[model samples]
Every structure is written in C-alpha cells, then in structure tokens.
Target: MGSRRQFIKTVSASGAGLVAASAMGVMQEASAHPTSVWGGDIYSGPHEMVKNSKILSIKNPDGTETLGVVTPKGVIDVRAVAKKMKISAPLTLDQLLQEGNAAGFNKVVASADKSGVPYLDESKITYGRLFKNPGKIICVGLNYRQHADEVGMARPAVPPLFNKYNNSLAAHNCVLEIPPPEISYKLDYETELLIVVGKRMRNVPEAEALNYVAGYCTSNDFSSRDLQLELPSGQWMIGKTLDQYAPIGPYFVTSDLVGDPNNLKIQTWVNGEMRQNSNTSDFIHNTQHMLSYISKYWALEPGDIVFTGTPQGVILGMPKDKQVWLKKGDKVVSYVEKLGELKFTLG
Candidate 1:
C-alpha cells in the first residue's frame, strides 16, 4: 500500500466523472440497502480494502453517529459522500470491519470531487468510540520488560491476560464520568497500543500473525488501583474494568499505514505533566506473539480488540510515597507514532 499522501494524490488526479461513472456501475450489482444504519452496530459484509486510509466515527447531534475517512484535506464524511454520489457504503467502522466493504468506501471517496464534497475540520466534530460492542475486549498485563522491572517484578514466562466489558470503551476527546469518590479513589492512567483484529482465526502461528490485524490505535487502560490491588484475590478486573476505563482512538489507522506496530514510540501525559514515556520496543511479548498466543485458545474475530500492555512510568510503578492518582478535572492524553493522540478528560 502507498503512503496517505500518495493515496490522496491518486484520488485527486483521477477525475470524479470517471471514478463516479465506474463506481455507479459497481454499486448497481451490489446487494440491497438495509432498512436503516445503526450507530456502532455490526454489519455482515466481510473486511475489504479501501485506500491506505485512517477510519473514525463522528457524533451527530441527534445521538446517532456516522463514519468518516481521514483524507489529506480533512475528514470526509463517508455517509454524506455516499449519499450525494449515490453509492453503496458502510455507515460504521464495525460495519466496514464486519462487511469488508473498503472497496465500496474507496469508490465513494474516489468519486468525490475534491471541491464538491464538504469535509469537516477534525476539531469541530465530536469523536465517537473507534469501535463499539466488539466481541471481546482482551488485555495484557505486565508485558513490557521495563515496566516489569520498574514495578519490582520478574518477567513472566507467559502473558497475563484479562478482559474488559463494553462499558469501558470511550472516544478520544470525550469526558469520562469517573466513578464516585467513595467507590475507589486510586484512579490511574496506563498508556498502551491497541490492536484490532481484522478477521476470524484460530491456532494461528507467530510466523504470520500480523496478517490477521485490521489496524492499530492508541488507548488508555484507565484503572482504579484501589479496587484492583486492595481486594483479596488481586481483583485485576475490578480495578481495571470500570466504565470508560478503556478510552481509545482519535483515529484507527489501517495496518498498511502502520507497518511496524512493535517499534512505535508510546507516551502518556496527565494535565500538562509528562507521566509515562516509552516505546513498544520494550514490550516483552510483541504484537505478533500476543495475537498468536491468544489465538491458540480463542478465535479472534473482526472488531475484537487486544490492549497490548503499557510501558513503565505508570503511577503504579512509582515509589509508594511519590504516587498520585488521577482526579476529576484531569486531562489524560496518550500518543503512538502514527496513531494520533487519544485525549480525554476525567469527571
């Protein structure tokens, strides 16, 4: 696949008349339209390729949302462009993932005359969760080599796995309604890279595991340390799986755009202070190994997300007296090399 800039050039050089005429012929043979499109809902189409582009969702005033494709000019509303051009397009990211309708979306984008369609200034739009209601929200624990050493623990022989529910998912720029102070006050931030599975697979070998990835994005495994550590059995889930705790996004760049998930630089900040800064290079179990290992027992499906572990510098790794938890009104930002910053506010 080509770079994003190169992809845009290809789209611009090809006249809309030619692209639209070709797209119209393709849409004519496609299946019937659904009664209506649902926000964050799944679609039946298989995963298909558009261009080497990033995907995201925007919140509409009516409580519904629509899908948009990131272009050099700005964010092109896929639904809007499809409507004006009269083409078949997936209305949600999950739909695109499940249906594999990238070709349809690509046609819509190609058919758009550069100046004919209206693109939204990214800041003006309220971002929605990169994905909603995925089949599984799998996570890794203590998988970063440096993080393990900092927290005073030896590297594990195998990956520690955990799970989070749908309620934990939040969008970039969204405000997290933190749990009540009485529930547990040790709120913490964990900056990690997220992996989105593109297809259904099982018993996949490490040699070709990355081929199954849909894309990569930035994420925060927002945690309540009190619930996690104070409990008798080390309630990792209770501590880690609170509502809005798994805030992700800003953009979901396709695997083609992010060639090396294991080499990106990852960092986190609280308010204006740098909190955690490290690279995925320190990951003990790299992306390919994590996916391959997890797939041994579970059939990874489209939209299934894996929260690859966070690096060192988390408050949990700080000296006992130096640790300070996140509070209401705090702004948390997480960034990965190609995946844009995932920002959110507490309270």
Candidate 2:
C-alpha cells in the first residue's frame, strides 16, 4: 500500500526487469505448409495448435498502438512487419482474441522471425494498455484467507464480486494521477492475479473452466479506502474504480505457458522494499471455482478480465499507527512468477 519516490532510479539496477522469450510450439511450422496436410480429406476444423505465447502492446511515437510478440531477440513489432509482408495480423490483444486469430497470430510470428525486421529493444518502446478494450473487468473480494483475516473479516460463503469500467485501465510503467486530496486520503495498492477470458461462456463447470481462459497477467487493484468504506453504499466500486486504477500487464501470457494459476508465487513492493509475499495457493476460492461461480451470472466473452483478490500485507491490514498511505511520487510493483512485473508511478 506504500511506495517511495526513488522507483525509476532504483528499477534500472533492481534486475527485476522483463525478459522476452521467443515463441515456442508448432503453429509457426504448420502454418507454413497448410496445404500439405491432406487438402481434400475430412476437415479437422479450427483449434489453437500452438503453445501459449506472450503478447504485448507497443505505443507508437504518434500515440497509436500496435501489437508486439516478445522473442529472445527482443520485441517483434507484428504490425510493422505484417504490412511489409502483406500478411494480415491483429494490431492489439483484444482483436487477436475476439477475432479468433490464433492461427493468423502464429503466422505473424514466423514471418517476423525470418523477415529481417529488426527487433525493438525493450527500453525503446513505451507500453500501451495490454488490453485495447475489455468487454468487462470483474473483480473478486476477500478470496484469500490471509487477506480476509488481516482485515478481521470472516470468510464469506460465496465469492464477492465487483466491477470496473474501461476508463480505469492503465499500462505497465504508466503514471497514475491520484485523485485530488479533497477526494481521498487513503490510497492503497493490492497485488492480484488477472484472468483473461478467451471464449464466450456461461454456466460453465469447474472441471472445464480453464479451457475458456485466454491467458493470465499481473494486476494492481489500486484503492482509496476513504471513498471505499466510508461511503453510504458500503460497497467498494467508487473508491476502487478511479481513472488509471487498474494497472495490468507487461504481457498477456496464454494458459499453456502458465501451467497452474493457483500455485504461483505473487508479491508486491513499494519502492523496491518487499511488502507482500504469498502464493496463489492461499486463495480461498481457486481459479476454477471463481470462474464457474462468475459465469453463472453473466456470459464471459473474449477479452473479458477478472481480478482475483489480493493476499495480506496491504496497508488496510496494518494497525492505525503503522499505516502509511501511498502519495504522489510513489512507485508500486506487482509480480507473479511466470507473469512479468507490472510497475507504475502514483502522482
């Protein structure tokens, strides 16, 4: 829930930087010879045949955004090379999911690798929101036992749900404008795992819920406790849904790459000092349970995201004398094992 002003200075020497890995799996090779695999035989229909790959948004100098694939060499500017090769590719993560362009996306990766297009150094590109536009941004509350206990609340029988709109979305390394002091005094940070829905679903069972996930990413449920708990409604939306409050990304890694979503290590830091250290294993309602429970009420479509609840160590759990609310010039970093760290500044 706290951050110091020296984040940018310390981040360079922190070695907690994002690493780009090349695309893996056979989709690249298979697409190269699609006609050779029995042209007139029974149709196998459409399916994603590759391993889950990492995708990101690269902000252009003019402020437009394009999709980039993280490779060992660097970032493959998909749109830049796709046009040069005269092949079609989605320019954003949302388009890649909503249009069912997995096959097309794979082809773009293969072409970029061979096209001699230079990879953009990670530092040279500014990140844009990982999701161009999410149809829904659902959030879960008190889903972790330790987090609930820290606030002196008993576990609820059902998963608590809340919602965030598109305006709240922010990119990794972006700057967040804290609401004027008149609006709130209690700015806090909650590190949570993000779930991205890949397919249209409703009333799904827990057994098959993972199949519907597009991928996973890191996220922060930035909050203002004064507006959240002190208001008349007693619900959390107002305090939690401020502009640039939901900072997510660095990469939207597919489920194939992220083996078990519930067992990974998750942590948060304020100005490089580790404040929260826990694993998703502490979740009271695991991934399958949360998805199944949510889909029962509303249909989840491609590009929809869900913010699973945070673990303990947030300022809200601290004693009144010890709590130091976040303020201007603070840096917050959220990290998950396979999903890279998401860093942001609060001003």
Candidate 3:
C-alpha cells in the first residue's frame, strides 16, 4: 500500500496543475419535470463549497465522520441513526443512493448535526457513493478521441467498454497497488469522469439516455500498460481491471445538478508529477452518444457505473525513452474538476 505522503504528493501535483474534469440508455421518455429526483433543488459545484446545506451524520451528526448532501427541506442526513440497532457508525456510499424514505436516514443526520462533527470542519457534506453496493462495475476504454490518438489507435466509432470487479472501487485515502515488480511494470494513472445509473433502461435513444443517471464521481482507470499490451491481439479488457484498476469516489453528484456531462475538466498526477491534463470537452464520443450506443446492446441498471475514458499523457503515449512505470509505494491521483479526487497507493 502507498503511504499517505506519496498519495498526497501525487494528488496535489495533478489536482493543482489544472482544473480537472456519462450515461446511458433508454427507450423511455423523461418528463419535462423530474420532481421526484433526490436533491432536485441542489446546485452543482465542488462539495466543500455547498455541502453544508446537505444532511449527513444526522443521528450522531456531531459524532462520526460522514458526507452531507443538500436537500430541498435543507439537508438530508445520510449517517443518521437507522431503525435497526447494531449498525455501523458511518454509512457506506451505496446506502445513501438506494431509493426509499430518507426519513430515517435524515433523522440521524439532523440529530447528529444538532451537536459535534469532524469529517469536514464545516458540518455540510456531499455524497460519495449513494451507498456501498455489491454489483458489477463497467468501464469504457479509449472512449476519448484525443486519448486514442495519443495511444496510437484509430478512433473507435462505438464506446470501447470493459469490466472491473468491485475490488477496483477506491474512495479517498485509498492506496493503489503497483504491479508486481518482476515483470512489465508500467502501471499508469488515468483521469476519468464517471456516472452511476439510477434507473434501469434498455435500448434507450441517445437523446434520452442521460435521464437514467443518478450522479457523477471521479475515477482513476489505473492500468499496467505493459501487461495490458503484452498480448498483441489488442483485446483491451485484460489490462483494464488490475487490482485497484479503478479508483472511484470523493462523492456522487446527481445528474439533475450536473448540467452538462461533457464539459468538465479531467486531470491526473503520478508521484507529484503532472502527467495527464485535459477536459471532458475532448471526448470523441460524448456521453449522449455513448448512452445511446450502449443501450442498443445492454440494459443499464441502477448502481451500474460508467467511467468515461481518460485523456492524453498516459505512459503508453509517452516517448519510451522517458517512460517510467509506477513502482511500489507510488501515488496516483485522478481528479475531475467538479467531482473531486480519487487517490490510491501502488504498494
């Protein structure tokens, strides 16, 4: 695992050098008004700036550390007391997103915020994951035009999708594992903007697919290029799902608040070095197109994640002479302008 120092160094470099920076399918028609949407009134921005109005840690608001999400009535507390006893102190990301009466969840945050909290200096919180979940995680590879060019591949007309098991999920304070030292080392960091599906939709049109998104988060599609490219056949999935291949989190922002999925900035850093820098603006196939395209093939379900491809500056794109694969203890950080940072250790 990477020490905290390395993680901080990498994240700071990438996050500082630039402003950093999805969804799917359907055959359904969204109403002009999405009144039932959670946090329908919430506006989009960095979590630190507006989470204070969110409800989190309600039951023991002043007690444990947790996220605070903005709600119409005020903030709907996510970590508040649950009806059942023997619950854990902090709630998982998936819990908050599951559809239901947030009433019980809110009560805990309301009660806790009524008192001591320290997750963030300010009481307000933004979501991370809707709640922790057990589900299949899907990702897109080389989905961006510039990224494909950088890697020396022709642009794929359709989204290049891949899979990563739950083990790839990483939240803040995570340490990514570097490839085993003996082989084709070259583990790299990729900055990607990710979205989670809130509802199930199959065969959705491109224009209507965005309606199924629940929220957005940041992810680092960490890869071992050497191992990935080891096979000349060019089947991309093998190199995509490394141990911590996907570092996701910081928080999940609902689609209602994020106006345009294609315009955010995405950036990456490796061990305090600025490596990849760009924006969602460069995507070859934007979210609308991907959603519509993917829907023609598979059904997108709630909690399913879509990680838009990373931008340029990956190691594979670097001149081999100057290339250096991530070693054990290296820190890789992927940041999206609005979603926040996803950090991990390569140990």
Q: Residue-wise lDDT of candidate 1 within 1-347, one digit each (tens)?
A: 46998988877878776888888877774534334255333345656644488988898787766688788888898877888887777777777776677777788878766527888888789998877878899999999998999989989887899999998989989899998889989988999999988888799999899889989889999989989989898999999988889998988888999998999999998988998889999999999999999999989998889999999999989998998888989999999999989999999
Mind giving the per-residue lDDT tens digits that candidate 2 earns over 79-160?
Answer: 8887777665567787777666577678888898678789999888899999758889999998889999999999988899
Instruction: Tell me the spans in candidate 2 whose CA falls farther than 4 Å from its real position.
Output: 1-50
What would the TM-scores of all predictions be?
0.86, 0.85, 0.70
How accurate locally is residue 65 in candidate 3, as Cα lDDT from 0 to 100? 39
By summed lDDT, the worst window of 10 consecutive residues in model 3 runs over 43-52
**Judged by TM-score, which candidate is best?**
1
Query: Which sequence of candidate numbers ranks them by lDDT, best first?
Result: 2, 1, 3
Q: What is the lDDT of residue 72 in candidate 1?
A: 84
Q: What TM-score should be assigned to candidate 1?
A: 0.86
Off by over 4 Å in 1: 1-51
